[model samples]
Target: MDRNSLIMSLPFRTSSPPLNWSSADCCNWEGIACDPRVAYNNLTNITGAIKILMRCKFLSVVLIGENFFHETIPSDDSIAHSNGFRNVQHLSIIGCHLTGQIPMWLSNLKKLKILRLNHNRITGSIPGWFSTLPRLKHLALTHNHFSGEFPKELCALPALISAQALENDTNTSILPLFSIFGRTIYQYNSVSSLWPGISLRNNSLGGKIPIEIGRLKLIRELDLSNNNFSGNIPSQMSELTNMERLDLSANRLSGEIPISLANLNFLAKFSVANNNLSGPIPSGTQLQTFSPLAYDGNAGLCGSPLPKECTHTVKSNKDKKTQDEKVGGHRIPWFQITVVLGFITGFWGVCSSLVLNCNWRNAYFQFLENLGDQLYVTMAVSWARLLRRLL
Candidate 1:
C-alpha cells in the first residue's frame, strides 16, 4: 500500500472531512502537523510514523500510546532506515499492549527526555543502557513483568528526577545493593533541583536495606513495601532530610524502629507494619501523628501512637516477684493476714462470750447504769460550781 493508503488502514481518521490526497499538501493531513522546521504526528500505529518520517525527515515528538498495538517492537534495522527518529524528545507508549523486551534500538534516540512504557506486557530486564540517555528525566516502567535486579546505574543519571518501577517481578537481595548506584550517588551531589524518588513496592525482594541508601539526599518519596526484607531499619535513613513519605510495611524486618528516624522533619507518611520489629515507636512529631495502623502487626513496638505500652521492665519485675514467691515456699503475708484474722476472731469471741452468759450480761448492764449515774452526778456538780463562780 502507498503511504496515504497505509495511514487510512489504521483505526484513526481525520477529524475534518475527507480531503483529496493528491491535491492537498500531506503536511495538512489531520492528526499530523508540521512547521517550517519540524513535524508532529499523533498516530494510532507506528506504521504511519515510519512512512511519514521517511518523507518529512524532521519529526520531533511521537505520541502513539493507548493505541492497542499488541505487536512486538520493530527491530532497529527496520525502524532506523533514516535519521528521522533520532531527534525524538518525548516518547510515550503507555498502555499500548506492546509486548517483549525494550528494543535495544532505543539507545539510538540520544535526544530522548521522557520515556514512558508503563502498563504494558514488556518483559525481561530493564537494559542498563537506559542510563546513558543524558537528557532522560522521567523513566516510568511500572506495572509490567520485567524481572532481574534493579538497574542501579539508573540512579546516577544526571538529569533523572523520577523513576517508577513498582508492581513488577524485579528481585533484589536488598535495597542497598547499589554496587552500581554507589558511584551514582556521588554524581548526584552537585545537582540541586532534582527531587528524585523510587517506588519498588509489591515484589519478592529480600535482604537488609543497606545503610548507603542515605546518600540519596535528593530523594523525597521511597516505597519498598510488601516484600521479604528482614533486619533493622537503617539509622542512616535519618539523613534523608527531604523525605516526605516512606513505606516499608509487610516485610520481615526485625529490630528496634530506629529512634534516629525522628530526625526526618519533612517525613509525612511512615509505616513499618507486619514486620518482626520491636521497641518504642519513635516519638518524633511526624511519627507520633501517623495512624496506629502504620505500626500495627508488629507486636513488640509500643508508644503513644500504638496501644501497646512499652512495659518491659514492669513485666520483668512481675516475673521476678512470681519466681521469688515460688522459690521462698509461698510465704503468707503475715502482717496483712494476721491483722484481718485477729480483728475477726476477737470480735466474734467477745460476742459469743457475751451472748452465752445471762448473769454476766445482766451485771454488765447494771454496772453500765451505775457508771452513768456517777458520771451524771459529777457533771451536775461541775456545772453548779461553774455557775456559782460566774455569779
Candidate 2:
C-alpha cells in the first residue's frame, strides 16, 4: 500500500507542509517531530490514537481536539495498566465526542501537567483522584454533564492554577472551612505566575458559598451563577484581593450584600441579581459602578442603582407593618372626604334653619295646620251629604 493511501485511511486530515511519508524519517512529517523531541499530533481518532500510544513510548504531549471519536473511553483495568502515555506531561481531548466518566486509567499518568476534557457529553460524578495529581496545573471539565457536588479535594491541589466546570450538573454546599483543612494548600502570593480561576456556573449547585474561598487569594475569577445557592454573600469573599471577576447571580440568596465587598479593588465584574436580597445596597465605588440590572428582581433591595428610595430605618416586623399601614392610610382620596362632609353640612344647615329661624318655624307649622283643617272640613261635608241622600 502506498503512503498516501495509508494516510488517507486514517480518519483525520493533516496540515501543510503535508506529511512527507516518502522521506525515510517519518519524524520529519508535518505534525510529527522528534529530537530528543516532542510529538504534536492533533485532530485524530481516539481509538486509533490510543492504539498507537499503547505501543509507543517516550511521548511528552498528546493533543486530540475537534474529532468525531464517538465511543466510551475504555475502562478495562488491563488496558489502563498498559504502557501508554506514561511519560506524557500535557494531554487534551477537548471537543471530542467522548462519553462516560473519565477513564480510570488516567490516574496512571502521574506526570500529567494539564488535563482538558471539556466540551463533551461526558457524564457522572468527577473522580476525586484528579486532585491527587501532584503536577497538575490546568484542569478543565466545562460544558459537560458532570453531576454531584464539587469535589472538595480539588481545593487541595497545591499546584493547580486554573479549574473550570461551567455549564454542568454540579451541586454542593460550600462549607465554612471547606478548603481551610489545616495547612495552606496554596503557597504562592496573589501575584504568582499562575492565574487560578474557578468557574461553576449554570448548574444545580446549592448552599452558601464557602467563606473559606477567601483563602484562594490568588484566584482571579470565581463564577457561581444560575444555581440554587442561598444565604448572604460571604463577607470573607472580600479577602479575594486579587479577584477580577465575581458572579453570584440568579439564586435564592437573601440579606444585604456585605459592605466589605467594597474592598475588592480589582473587582471588574460583579453581580448578585435575581435573588431574595434586601436592604440598602452597600455604598462604594465598586458597588455603585454596576448597573441597575445587576440589582434588579430583588424587590427588597433599594438605593442609588435602583429607583426605589429608602426612608426611615425599620428593624422589627411590627415597625415595618405599622409604617406600611400609615403610608397606605395617607393615600386615601380627599374627594371622598369632601363628599361626606358636604352631605353632613347640608343636612345640618336645613335642620338648623327650621329650628333657629322663627319665620321658617312658623311657616312650617302653618302648612301643617292647613293640611289638618282641609281634611276635617271634607269629612263633615261628606257626612251631611250621606244623611240627606238617606232621607
Identify the candidate with maximal lDDT. 2
Per-residue lDDT tens digits for candidate 2, residues 1-391, read 2455436535565443364565643445556543221122333446544644444465555655566456675576766777676666657676666787788888887666556676677877767797667555556665667666656666555454333321131321121111111285533221122345666566566667766566665567676777677888889888877788888888889999888888899887888889999998886557878899889889999887889987766579977666655654675455788999999999999889999999998998899899999999999999999999999
The residue ranges of model 2 lying beyond 4 angstroms of the native Cα positions read 1-9, 12-45, 51-61, 86-90, 111-113, 160-194, 311-391
Cα lDDT for residue 62, model 1? Answer: 51
Whole-model Cα lDDT per candidate?
0.64, 0.66
Which sections of candidate 1 miss by over 4 Å? 1-9, 13-31, 34-63, 73-89, 109-113, 160-195, 203-212, 226-232, 314-391
Instruction: Find the 10 residues in a row with the least total lDDT in model 2.
Output: 172-181
Candidate 1 local lDDT, 1-391, one digit each (tens): 2545645754465544445444233555555555321212333545554445434444445545666467665555655554555656556666666787887667777666556676677877667787687656546565566665555665555444333321131321111111112155522221122235555565555667877667656577677777677878899888878788798999899989878888888887788889988888866567888899999999888897888777855558867776665745775575798899999999988778879999878887899999999999999999999999999
TM-score of each: 0.55, 0.56
